[model samples]
Target: MPEFAISADPIFGTYALWVGTLLAIAGVILFVLGTLLKRDVSQVWLTYRGWLIMIPTLFGTVMLGRTASVLGVAALSVVSFKEFARATGLYKDWWHTCTVYLGIAGLAIATLLPDPTTGANGWHGLFRTMPVYVIALLMIIPVIRNKTDGQLQQVSLSIVGFAYMGWMFGHLGFLANSPHFHGYVAYLIFAVEINDIAAFTFGKAFGKHQLRSNVSPSKTVEGALGALAVAMALPWVLHFSFPHFGTTELILTGLIVGIGGQLGDLTLSFIKRDLGVKDMGQSIPGHGGFLDRVDSLIIVGPLFFHMDRWFHGI
Candidate 1:
């Protein structure tokens, strides 16, 4: 199969076409609602506009082949970590922040390197163990600086930055090494984004009780369940994306995107609550930040990757 061209993968091309068509239809609907009903949808328009840019960029990157996709994901991890560092006051500590940056870079390189033992495309072993080396280095930073005061917080933040933002997010990049990368990468991303939309739409329509009042007051149990339902159903709906998957793999994929995706969002919410911030940053027009956009993938990526690997050894 051709790996470098978008037309090479029928699944990827068809999925992209469907997404673009849906977005166009959504735009028309939103325009009609605002024009005919005189309803205010400026915020929704902003979000729709963001998706217009993001979707194309994402599809374009994946179209460029494995190297481009891996590098693009790595760049995303870097920016996402930057947002986290800035929000958590870790950016002020150059040592910790820079080390985290290095760790993230290391992950990207690991994703691109050939396996030493098998001469395969990606160094899965090294990628899996990157966190260990990153954490050890984070722990030793204070020692090298000969400082004890505030070192605990610094080290902790550094470790979280590297492990969560770097390693966890890198799993998405590592997926590019798989032979079925075209379908796997596109489907996971599309599914996760749809899951977010489901949550918002459900919450607005039927939300009665808050899901986590302390962490995120806006989220609701109804919304979460609705999103989960959509996520669970998506695997079957998009079965063409992974024809090799059996019942077991399909169920696992559902759980990974449904439950794991929400858990990841909640994890970021907890961090934001403790940090006394609403959004990580205002990078994207309506998405809050890169971190906000990718929070779900932090958990979903690893879960999906391991599941796929367990079954397909990818």
Candidate 2:
């Protein structure tokens, strides 16, 4: 009888790799679909499908826990920030937007540093570095004050632009740096995406009561409940299949991630509503822009990271 040899690598690694690959392929498909469907389909549908593709790609890449993942996120963040800034008219002064990009690049570099003991430390370093650089850049604003009538508005916009886009997106690096950060990327993506899908599916199927019509017309009470149901269900599945997270931990995580994801979506919607713009930008074809694609992730990342740290000791 011939002896059989088994691979040393566990099945989990193979599964994760497959998941990541599939996500990347799906992103490409969606991008193509968005391009081809531009005139034939409604922006809403295009945007929906586009996001369905892009989120998974980012989620999968982040899960790989490589330098490329960090760079990928930083690049996405910069594009999204630019889109939001442009839409809000906050970047009318091109210099402010440039300054923001500079700050984001600096933060990204700091986050990529070889070793950090804690996620919180990475965040602290990023937060500390950004303000100092931004402040130095802002000092130049007074000299350029003659260009704009309202000096305060320019200053305020600069600060808000950096804080909203750069700071929020930087949290991903922090999350990636966590001790048990190994699985966090997938966890965050699953929680946020599932919540969105549940809400949308339920709202379309059984949404009678409105949650916030003015801000986001499609959202409804039924949808919210549906999202909550899916959110709660995630723990049950994870508990038995993945020993890494206990039942109690999963339950807490699901709630925080679910709620935060929904909040992120609504908050971005509010911004779009205020700006009277249909989409953030045309970068992602149907998705509008990178910001639109990652809105929920932005909100959920920090909350989940901190919550997991507190609860799971990650």
Pick out the ten consecutive residues of candidate 2 with the lowest summed lDDT.
Answer: 1-10
Per model, state how many residue pairs clash. 0, 1
- C-alpha lDDT values of all predictions: 0.91, 0.70
lDDT of 1 by residue, 253-280 (tens): 9989989989999999999999989899
Clashing pairs in 1: none
lDDT tens digits by residue: candidate 2, 290-311: 7887899888776776676676
- TM-score for each candidate, following the candidate numbering: 0.95, 0.77
Model 2 spans > 4 angstroms off = 1-60, 114-140, 143-148, 240-242, 312-314
Q: Candidate 1 local accuracy as lDDT?
A: 0.91
